[model samples]
Target: MSVEATGETRSVVTAATIREILVERAGVDPDVFTGNELLSLAELQIDSLAVLELQAVLVERFGVEIPDESVTMTVGEIAAVANEDR
Candidate 1:
């Protein structure tokens, strides 16, 4: 379901959305993610190629354009940014 379809009543921020994307794409163990935790690509073993894949997924899934400035963000930070954009 799309984020809106979740019927959560509260708005989902870009940071949260990005966090969800990471969780799904990285196969991150749920217990390890708080959606507000600092996420390190190196720690997660995510490579440059994987980052590109993530960019594609975020665009496709959320229809939000990710800018170059966003590349420096951690997973949680990205979601927060996304929330602001939406």
Candidate 2:
């Protein structure tokens, strides 16, 4: 429950890490994208199963548990939350 031992945490998440994950999962080039851009499913060509995979990857990488119901249908939301956690 304590984040003290893990050292200080930051309120903002790094754009680089999020970009990397997006590139890896969504196949969108991170170099051309910014965090503010809305990532639609059609744009990323992501399906339902891919979404679950992305969620798992986020949880595993960031140590944050995102409820299945809370996983928005847009990549932007996921990036925002993950960035904050990071």
- Index of the highest-lDDT prediction: 1
lDDT of 2 by residue, 1-86 (tens): 55677786644434455456657875655545554456554454545555566667667766765446433435555556666534
For each of the candidates, the C-alpha root-mean-square deviation to the true structure, in angstroms, is 6.1, 4.2
lDDT of 1 at 16: 51
Question: Model 1, 2-84: lDDT tens per residue?
Answer: 55788645445455565566567856555544543675554555556556666788677656555555545676666665556
The candidate 2 region of ten consecutive residues with least summed lDDT is: 65-74
**Clash pairs of candidate 1?**
13-83, 14-79, 14-80, 14-82, 14-83, 15-79, 15-80, 16-79
Residue pairs in candidate 2 whose N, alpha carbon or C atoms collide under 3 angstroms: none
Q: Candidate 1: which stretches are off by over 4 Å?
A: 1-20, 23-36, 68-71
